[model samples]
Target: MGLLDSWTAGSHTADGLTYPTYRKGSGPGVIVIHEIPGITPGVIGFAEQVVARGFTVVLPSLFGRPEGPASAGEALRSIARICVSQEFSLFALGRTTGCAPWLRSLARRLHDELGGPGVGALGMCFTGGFALAMLADAPIAAPVLAQPASPAPLGRARAADLGLGPADLASVKAKVAAGCQVLGLRYDRDPAVGTRFDTLRRELGDGFVAVEFPGRKHSTLTEHPQPEGVERVLAFLEEKLTTKPET
Candidate 1:
């Protein structure tokens, strides 16, 4: 059977952009934005964990072939496609990815469909910072960034960049100040993550919950599969989406 054979397939469109989505489970919503090379087995496995936890999960196939292998060639191809696509902001400093609006729309739709505290959004690898960006405008109570690598992290400026524009950053700060918290996981030596964790700490203050592991590997919640990191993520989602917030 295919890796995603059990998931319900659908499509979501916003601002003239459309992408295929796979969904499963039922309860509070969690949008799992796949990393580079598309929805591979690892990504699917992580999504299944979320589904098994009694939360609805949506996996968006941004680029690359679904159920495709995460081989070097496939990664290169996906990188090339994203580098040229107008939907991504790979090299720009302090700019939110062009796909944020569509993702935010999806989050809004999910939250509306299943009313509650709010939905959780997790982004991995190249799309990791997307959850933070979506929190600025969407009903994303729980935002998780798993090894966010963006703007190529080529220079010092790009390295510290949070992959968010000025206005969105301000909005996120406000939300965090009010009560929202962002969860970030990354390897301490992962060069692709750059200095954004520092930036998040500086910007979000006590609101950014950072879980760092050792070594230089990336893809904390998937490729590397850090057990502690996975447990922390699941806990964070439950706290923010399932439990009622104190007023």
Candidate 2:
């Protein structure tokens, strides 16, 4: 159903977990993390975009099993549907809510099994800062965060997200101190990812770099003129995890 007419999408299982995913393209590995909309048409388009850039892009379906992006206004309604359908258990909610530990394992397996030194991550919107959390593990060599929603959920969402909750903040600071670099982008107008969120970079000392788009909104990277943004994302990764050109 995507431009990659020969789309080979299915479920990938590792460590006893089965995750629905789409895989294609060639080069170093790059995992594409979808925003609140789930893997909607736009995100699949982004996956195709990344594939065009010469990287093996994998978009996993983590919307509590049966997941796909819905209408903007119906996101909450969709959440309710996923909650009830997933059996609504506390532990299940914690595991399915955040894309951290599982994604970490997937990246590691890709590096160890798929034969890449490591993998690059592109996380956006609600998942903006997720790439940073993925970096907590060394297998993620390059992390790209776009329009990261700041940690201030009107409830439990904040606790589930990676917004530096003291202990976790301390751990990330340690990774940055050990020479990890994270690149993040945001539109100046979106209130979810505000100036205060920039403190995460400040907290990281020199390892964090944030670039701002003066007028672009939260979903700015939905398409081009955003091509350059996507290119920069790959370039940043190559800078960190580049392999020698073949002889």
Candidate 3:
């Protein structure tokens, strides 16, 4: 808590893409994945909140960040900029070349530098499935996947850009069979990820901890103040990351 109050930000690149990062606290590491827009102050605030709970926080701008600090208006403007940009690089920011290895390298550095067994990962909205995809690498011990967007059309049939393929899904199944638990948070509504994710829930079964917040929509879990879900998620992280080894 004391360390995070005076926290500072940093910049780095992962998977051959440049990204702005934030660091704080002084214990085991946790990677805080940003929402669709980027690593806004609200997301950083969330990182700080997690740091206050006594874990070191690492935030990579999956999408590029602003030249200045990001307020809501700034973040909204950034979204517009990306939407209007010719290339829309924000969507490709952290995903350059080989993303899985990039995340694994970052985790390795955090574990070796921070002196922890491994790192926890939390992804939101568009990037939610990433935490699960990352589980293929094994360094992602505790994964919190929130409101994942579609990887491929969904609904009565297929879904676009749902973010996982057969191999990735198979690896996840293997991890679950090995007793690894994954936590997922979502609101009852949000068609973009609604029923498709529910199917995944059934697919994963007991290996997945599904925490659905009634009446809330996508991304409220990461943003907090919803009168439900966020605090419960914090508790869930505590349960997984802070679990005692029973010998």
Each prediction's TM-score versus the true structure: 0.98, 0.79, 0.78
> lDDT score, residue 213, model 2?
73
lDDT score for residue 101 of model 1? 94
lDDT of 3 by residue, 1-247 (tens): 4323365667665556555666777667888887756765557667777788878888875565533344566557666755664422323321311355666677777877766446788888666767876777657677887877634234344332335556777887788888778887777676656455656666687888877767645676545435356676677667666647679
lDDT of 3 at 99: 55
* 1-247 per-residue lDDT for model 2 (tens digits): 5343455677766545677877887888888887765776677777777777778888876662223444755556545654574321222211222446677877886677556557888787766766776777538878888877635344555434454345555766787787877787767676666553456555766688766777746664663236667667767867766587689
Model 2, position 82, has a per-residue lDDT of 46
Whole-model lDDT, candidate 2? Answer: 0.65
Flag clash pairs in model 1: none
Model 3: residue 65 alpha-carbon error in angstroms: 2.6
Report lDDT (Cα) of residue 115, candidate 3.
60
lDDT of each: 0.93, 0.65, 0.65
Per-residue C-alpha lDDT of model 1 across residues 75-106, encoded as one tens digit per residue: 99998999899999688988898999999999
